[model samples]
Target: MTRMNYQSARFLTSAPTLAQCPPDDGAEVAFAGRSNAGKSSAINTLTRQKALARTSRTPGRTQLINFFTLGDDTRRRLVDLPGYGYAKVPEAVKREWQRHLADYLRGRRALRGLVLVMDVRHPLTEFDQTLLGWADDQDMPVHILLTKADKLKSGAAKSALQQVRSRLREWEDLVTVQLFSSLKREGVDEACARLDAWLADPEPA
Candidate 1:
């Protein structure tokens, strides 16, 4: 497999709807989670950049689908979906975001897989399950990142990992879960390896 130089990540564009997204030219992986679930921080850590995905103290700061290209290649892209399940947002706006997110997930041909981030202490929320179910229906692979693992003790963290792993047994073939910490940079290589596999083509030019 060709190693992706994630450090070469660069902001590409932000799209409000799927219609505005870049051309569906090559494989792309999407990062998604509820608001304040450490999705942004995980992206930054994976790319080895401080502000690549724009972490915010306030939840629901990412209101658009932000795209980033790897190594000056427009074909290999990473998408940051808007953080969902934030209570402060208006009901109408929330409904619209849900529609857009669903459409993107269901219809985007270039989307190869999803990286779902969840807080280690609070894994598998209703929203997370909803997204996971959608991926399963589409036969899309998902990698769950239990972010903020550093906040828990070593034994507790291990327990949390085991619990989530066991819960994911039903979809073991399509889903994989791992403990990750943006602060400590845990599981970076594993996460990258998964992404590399997803983005790799069986027949290369």
Candidate 2:
């Protein structure tokens, strides 16, 4: 595959449930985070597009699992998973999405790695740790983006970064953490480097 031109990313499809997702036969990296965590903003910044991934004030506005192909190639994709947090949706629907999200995380063969976005101010939540555990179960590598770094002072952001690292020390070999600011376009290259390595891998298993 040619090197990913993230700028070329465009929406490919959206699936309401795992069963509706695109064919499970290619390399993809999924971005997931809690509500209002700036996952969409990080994606937009990374792709150099203002609205490549929808940004909303309302959390979980789109419960669909959105997929975007790199440079029009379906084999390489970026997935925007539904954000976790307070939503106006029904409990049953939330539960259903959770089931499928877990199923996808645990079994999706095409997934190369996971990009777990999080608010730098609130590094790891209970749900975040739960997702990390799932990643661990499948031996999937995770690169966490502590988004909204711009919200903190230079020294404060670094401190938060260190705290997250310290907490995740046990999973150091499998998880990588970094401070990110979609507003400042910071850490884009570092995140890209990790994504490139994962998406370009010849064999996933």
Q: Largest TM-score belongs to which candidate?
A: 1
For residues 1-205, could you state the per-residue lDDT of candidate 2 as single tens digits? 3456899999999998778899998799999998788999999999999999999888888788999998867888999999886678888987877887898898789999999999999878988999999999999999999999999999999999999999999999999999999889899999998888888853545
Candidate 2, residue 40: the lDDT equals 93
Worst 10 residues of 2 by lDDT: 196-205
Q: For candidate 1, lDDT tens digit of each residue in 46-96? A: 999999999888899678999999977888889999998964879899888
* Cα RMSD of predicted structure 1: 1.7
Per-residue lDDT of 97 in model 1: 87
Show the colliding residue pairs in model 1.
none
Task: Please list the C-alpha lDDT of all candidates, in the order they appear.
Answer: 0.91, 0.90
Off by over 4 Å in 2: 1-3, 202-204
lDDT of 2 at 8: 91
Off by over 4 Å in 1: 202-205
